[model samples]
Every structure is written in structure tokens, then in C-alpha cells.
Target: MDIQVTKIGMVSCSGEELPEGTISRIACRKVLTDLKPNETVTICLPLFIAGGEEERKFAKKYPTITVDGCEKLCAAKSTEMFSGKPSKSLVVPDILKKHNLSAPKKLRHFGDEDQAAIQAVADEIAKSVKEVLEND
Candidate 1:
């Protein structure tokens, strides 16, 4: 017997140089690991861009949500360029502004102070995942 389960592909920004980028990655980790572990899968931006067959194929076959840490939108753009347009795209700074939260300054290590921003971003990513699933 073969059955298929619908899954949402999550792509997080690869911008490690910015604090927002770190926040984006952390948020995505939470969503993949804690928030939507069973419903979502991570589509790494670097590996996808490097032409990973599995990553590209999955993005092409399933709905995807992109989380961008900066205005450049590296994750979303790359996903669109390599596979197809993401069903939902989220920006970290915009998410913070929308939630009335402050971004953490630490680029490498996050403390309790960064929890709000991290949680907000993770929540948004989880929401996006749900949205894509519902639409599918």
C-alpha cells in the first residue's frame, strides 16, 4: 500500500550576516522542529540553489513558504528562480513590525530577550505553513 501525505516546504533565508537572518533561521528551526514538525519540511536555501535534485523537485511538487530575513529576499527569489513561486513568503523585519516586537541585536547567540522576536517569526512561519496546507 502506498499513500502520500501533503507537506509544506519551508525555505529560510540564508543571510547569516544580518541579525534578522539569524532570527529567520532560528524561527524556521522552531517551526520545523517544534511548531509544525509533522506538517512541514525544511527546504534548505543553499542546497536548493546548489541544484539539489530532491530539494528542487520537492519544491516543484509541493507548496512552499519562504521566510526572508532581509529586504533582499534571497530565499524567496532563489526558490522561485530554481523551482517555482512560493505559495507564501514572509519577511522577518516586516513580521516584527507587524507584531510590534523588537528584533534582537545579537547575531550569533540569542538570549531570553530575543525570545519575543524568535517566537513571533516562528509563529508567522507556522501560520504560513498552515495557510499553504489549507489552500492545498
Candidate 2:
């Protein structure tokens, strides 16, 4: 016998001005394509905040993880306001601080150091995905 579970929703900041925002997006893609392909779906923040879309509707019914690029936490805040609080929340700055990583300074291009930070964020998100799947 096999039991199937609903996929986790991922909402990440889309801000283009910050490196953290870029990191958030890349990490989300890693989770979807590499880490949790069979167990996750990407939720578009622009669609969710813009009013009408299937992503928001799907998020309302599933366990969602919100990834924020900055302390402002637009992704988490929007998810909470439109649906409910996310099942898990990740902030790039906080993660970097916890891991003793310096924040990325460039937005257009990333160096090797930034790649390391991105990898750390992706790893943590993948771990959270595992936790949510197991608990669900």
C-alpha cells in the first residue's frame, strides 16, 4: 500500500535589489528541482499579492514555506495576510548570520563566496522540506 501526500508550497521574495532576494529565488529553485521535486510546488508572490491566481488558492489549502530575503519579510507577511501563517519561514540574513556568513554585496553577479551562502540556504530549506514531509 502507498500513501501520497500533498506538496509543500514555496513562496520566496522576488525583490531584485538585494542579493538575498536572488539567493532566496535560487534556493527555492534548488528545492523544487533538486531537493524536493516530488514534494513541493512554487508559489508566486506577485500572483498571490496581486489578487487572483491558482498559486494563492493552492497555498491556502497546503502547507507552505515562506522565504524572505530581508528582515522586512514580505513573503511571510503576505502569506500570513492572504492565507495563514506559513508552516516554515526562512530569512536569508538570519541564516547567514547563524552560519557566520557575510551578506552578499553584489546583485548582478555572485562569486564563489556567495555560492557557498546560497548552498547553505538551499540545504537548510531542503532540511525543512524533509521535516514538514515527515510530520505531515
Candidate 3:
């Protein structure tokens, strides 16, 4: 027998101004595509905020995690405003600080040093996915 579970939605902030935003998006893609493909669905921030009914409905029905690039918490705040509260809110900068990793300064293009931040954030997102699934 196989038991299937509902996938968690990951809402990543679409901030392009800061490197952390780039990190946030990259980390989320890593988690969604490689780390937790079976456990997560990507919710486009632009669409979610632009009144995407499907996105909003998915958030309301399933457990969602918002990954924000900075302290502004754009993804988290927008999620709460449009849909409901997210199960977890992962901040890239905070995660970096917690893991003692420095935020990558490069924008569009990243260097070898940036990989640590990406991996760390991806790991955090994957970890959050597990916790939310377990608690669900």
C-alpha cells in the first residue's frame, strides 16, 4: 500500500533588489525541484499577489511556507493578506545568520562562495517542509 500526502506550497519573495532575494528564489527552486519535489509546490509570488485564485485557494487548503529574502517579509505578509497564515516563514538572511554563513553579494550571477548560502537556505526550506508535513 502507498500513502500519498498533500504537497506543501512554497511562496518565495520575488525581490530582485537585494542579493538575499536572489538567494531566496534560488533556494526555493532548489527545494522545490531537487530537495523536496514530492513534498512541495511552488507558488509564484507575483501571481499570488495579483489575485491568482488557484494560488490563493491552494494556500488556503494546504499548508504553505513562505520564504522571504529579507526582514521585510514580503512573501509572508502578502500570503497572510491574500490567503491565510503560512505554516512556516523562512527568512534567508536569518537562516544565513543562524548558520553563520554570509549572504552572497552577487546579483544575477553568483560565485562559489554563494553556494553555501544557497545550500543552507535550501536545507532550511527542506527542514521546514518536513516539520510542516509532520505537524499536519
Provide the lDDT at 32 for model 1.
80
Best-to-worst ranking by TM-score: 3, 1, 2
Pick out the ten consecutive residues of candidate 2 with the lowest summed lDDT: 1-10
Clashes found in each candidate (C-alpha, N, C closer than 3 A)? 0, 0, 0
TM-score of each: 0.94, 0.92, 0.95
After superposing candidate 1, which stretches have Cα over 4 Å from the reference? 1-4
Residue-level lDDT tens digits of model 2 in 85-108:
899999999998989887688984
Q: How far is 54's C-alpha from truth in model 3 (Å)?
A: 0.4
Clashes of 1: 0
Q: What is the C-alpha lDDT of each candidate?
A: 0.88, 0.87, 0.90
- Candidate 3 lDDT over residue span 3-84, tens digit each: 1356999999999999999998999999988999888989999988999988888888889899998899999999999989
By summed lDDT, the worst window of 10 consecutive residues in model 1 runs over 1-10
TM-score (C-alpha) between model 2 and the true structure? 0.92
Task: Count steric clashes of candidate 3.
Answer: 0
- Across residues 1-136, which tens digit of lDDT does each residue of candidate 1 receive? 1113678888999887898999988888899899998888888888899999899999888888999988899999999999999999999999999999888877869899889999999998888878778878
